[model samples]
Target: MISPLGQSFRVSKVFKRCPLEIQGFVFSADLIELSFRKFNLILGMAWLVEHQVGLDCVSKRVTLKVGDGEEVVMVGERRDYLSIVISTMVAEKLVQKGCDAYLAYVHDTSAVSSTAEGIRSVKDFSNAFPEELSGLPPDREVEANIDDDPNRAEFWLENTIRVFDELSCTPEECMKCVVSLLRDSTYQWWNTFVSVIPKERITWEFFQEEFRKKNINQRFINQKRKEFLELKQGRMIVTEYEREFVRFSKYAWECVSTEAIMCKRFKDGLNEDIRLFVGILELKEFIMLVERACKDEELAKQKRKAMIEARDTRKRPMSKSFQPQSKRSKETNLRMTISSEYSH
Candidate 1:
C-alpha cells in the first residue's frame, strides 16, 4: 500500500466483511492491518459506494442507506487534542498517500505567562523578546568602522549595558543577550575569544573588561581625556558647548567629580562676554549654571540689539518737517543771504 508521502508499506493482513457498528447501525467493511499511526481504521471508497453512504464534511455528518431502505444520519463528535510530533519518515509516508498535510509552528506560552507573574520576571526575559526578537537580527551594512572609531564600540557597549539595567537583566542573561546583538566581525571575534578563555571563568564583568581592552585601547581613552581637558566653548553656543562637555566629561572623571567642580569647569569654557555675567552668580549646580548662562546670553543679545538701535537712531537723517524750528530758520536765512550776495 502506498502511504500519503509516496512511501510503500506492506499490508500485513486483510479481513473481508468485517462488521462495523456506527451509531447502533451495523455495516460490513474490509479491514486491513497497516503500520500507520494516524488512524485506527480507514474506510475505502468501495465500502462507501456499496452502502450508499454520503459524507457532509462541512456539517461533519454521515448519511447511511441500509439494505432495508432505511436512512440514518450520524453526527460527528468534535475532539480537541494537543499537537503531535511525527518523524520525517512517517510524515513522508502520510504525504505519499495523498493526505492533506500542514505544518504548524507552536510556542510554549505557559512558561512565558508563569515567568511574567514571578518576582524575578524582569530578569528572565529581554524587553525585545517574543516580538522584537521574533526573527534573526537584520543584516545591515556597518556604517562606522569599529576599528577606526573606538568611541562607537564604547557607545554600543554603554547603550547595551543601559538597556540591560533598565530590563533588570541578570549577569547570565546579559551575557546571552549581548552575544546575540553582535554581528559580522564582532561575532567572529567573540567566538575566537571564547575558544581561548575557559567558559567557567567568563563572567559579565570579565567579558566587559576584555571587550574594552581589545576595542577601546588605553591610548584612545587618554586622547579623549586630553580632548576633554582642552575643550572650550569658543564659537559654540551654550547648548552646543554643553552637549560636547557632557559627551567628553566621562573620559576625565577626576576633573568634574562633583556638581560644584562640573559647574566650574563648564563655566570656565564659556566665552569671555558670557562668563563676565554668569561668573558673578557663582552657581554651584551644573543644571542651574547652564540655565543661567543661556539666560545671560539672551540678555546680552537684547542689550546689543538695543545699543545698535540707539546708535542707528542717532545716525539717521531727520526730515525737514520734523527738524527744530530754530535749526530750520537758520538754514533758510543762510540760503537767502547767500542768494542776495550772489546777486550783488
Candidate 2:
C-alpha cells in the first residue's frame, strides 16, 4: 500500500485507479502475499493503515480495512506473520523514541487484535526486529587504528596479554573482568542516550497508541516465563538466575557503550600503558573485593555453625540433669497416691 511517506502504495491512489494487474480494481485481494522483507523501513505506511482502517477479526477473514470499507483478507497463517511484523515495526519506533513501548503495545492489541498476536512486549519486538535499526556507526570507524603507533601499542598490549595469560584466573573470571572494563568505558554513551530522549515530547497516550500497534510487553512476559521454566528444569529458581542475568546484561550494555566512546580516543594517541592500567585496575579491584567478601561470609557461617554445635553439646548435659528431676517427681507422685489411699 502507498503510505504518506511514499514508502508504499497510497490507498487513495491505488483505489482511484485499478491497475490491470490488480484485475477489476480489486486491491483488497492483491494485498495478500505482498511482504516487505525489511518492514521496518516502511513503518510509516503500516502506521497509516493501522490508524485509518483498524483491524477486524471475523470467523472467515482477518481483514485490514481502510476508509470506505476497503478490506484485505488473507490466509490465517499469513495474517499472523504480517501482524507480527507490522506490530514489531511500530513498537521499535516507540522504543527508539524512549516511550514505554511495552505499555503502548498493550493498547495497540485492542485497536488491532492481530497486532499483538505473535508479540507480547517491546523486548519481543527487539528480538524480532534486531536488524531493523542500523544503530550508531561502528567503533573502529570512530577511532584511529591502535597499530598506528605500532611499536608502542603492540609492546603495551603484549605485556597486558602476557600478564593475563600468566594469571591463574579461570576463563569465566577473566571474561567478567574484561566485561567490567568495557562497561566502565561506555558510561558516557548511556548518558548521551538518556539526554537525547525528549521526555516532554513523548506523551503516555502516544506511547499507548504505538504500543497497541505492536504488542511488545506480552512477548517479553512470555519470554521471561519460558526462561523461568528452563531455569527451574535445571534446578534453579528463575529469580536467582535472573539476578545474575541482569548483572551480565548490564555489563554487555556497558561493553558496547564503552567501546563506542573510547575506541576513538584510544586510537587517536592515548598511551597504551594508561589504557591498560585503567582497564585492568577496576577489574583487579573488583576481583579482590569479591574474593575477600566470599571468604568473610564463609568464615562467619562456619563460626556460627560451631557455636550452635557447642550450645547443643552444653544443653545435652543439662537435659540429662532434668532426667533425674523427672524420676524424683515420679517417685513423689507414687508416695502421695499411697498416702491418700491410706488416709481414706
Candidate 3:
C-alpha cells in the first residue's frame, strides 16, 4: 500500500517473474522502509534475517545485532505521514554493516540463534540467515457550525477523549493527536486557536485550565446554557428529556456545576405540570430530581390517558337512536381531534 504522503511503490512483478526463487524469500510489500536515499535494490525479510537486523521502534532506531554489538541507523521519514524513506547509500551501509556484524556473530557456532553453514566465517551471502520474521500489527467543527451544534461539538470532545484514553497518553499528547487529525475548516480553526494561545510549552492540564479565560470559546457554552434553559419536558418522554438536559448541561458548566444549581436547572426545564407534580420541594439532590422527573412523566401520561378516556365517555352517544350516524364516527372524530391538537 502507498504511504499517506503519496510515496507510491510497485514491485510485484519481480516476484511474479521468479516465483520459485523469490516467492517465500521476499515480496513487494516489504519495501515500506523509512528510506533516506534511492536504492538500486530493495531488501526484504530474507536480507534482514541474514543480517540480523533488529528494529527498535520506541527510540526510532534500527539496530543490527551482529557480532558482539549493534549500531543505530537513522532512517528519515516523510513529514506528511511519518513514513520512513532512505537513500541508496544508507541502504548499502545498512547491508554492509549488517553482513559484517552478522557474519561475525554467525561464524561462532555457539551464537545459538543462528547457524551459518560451516560455522567458521562464511564467505557467501545467501545462506547466513534465519528462517522467520515476526508479524507487524499497525472532525471538526465547532465554532460556526459549533454554535449550530453544541451536541455535535461535545460528541467530538468525548470521542477524542476516548481515543486518548485508549492510548494512556498524557493530556498534551492527546490534544496534539486530535489536532493533527483535523482538516479543512476545522483544521484552520484549530490552527487559529493555536496561534492565538500564548506561545509557551505548557502541559495540557495547564492549558485546559487557562484556555477559557484566554479564548473566545464561551459561545458554545452559552449556546448550551440557552438550550438547557429552553428545554421543556412537555412532549418529550422523561428519558429523552433527561438525555437533552444532560447534553445541554455539558456545555453549561457555570449554571449547573453544583448539586443545588443542577437540580434547580433540571427542575426548571420540566413541563409546568410535571414540575408541579414532582414538587421542587422534594428534589433536594440531582438523583432525586431525575427520579421524580421520570415519575412525573409517567404520572403525566396516566393523567393524559384518563382524560382521553373521560372525554370519549362524554362524547359517546347515550341513546341507541343517536348512535348510528356512522360506524367509524366516534373513533374517527377522536383521531382527528388528537392529530389536530398535537400536530405542532
- Mark the 10 consecutive residues where model 2 has the least summed lDDT: 14-23
- Tens digits of per-residue lDDT for model 3, 48-90: 7865667766565555444446443555363333233444335
User: What is the alpha-carbon lDDT for the whole of candidate 2?
Assistant: 0.42
Model 1 C-alpha lDDT versus the unseen true structure? 0.81
TM-score of each: 0.52, 0.20, 0.42
* Ordering by lDDT: 1, 3, 2
Give residue 192's error in model 3 in angstroms.
8.7
- Which has the greatest TM-score? 1
What's the lDDT for all of these models?
Answer: 0.81, 0.42, 0.60
True lDDT of residue 60, candidate 1: 78
- Model 2 compared with the native: what TM-score? 0.20
How many Å off is the CA of 201 in candidate 1?
3.0
Segments of candidate 1 deviating more than 4 angstroms: 1-145, 318-344
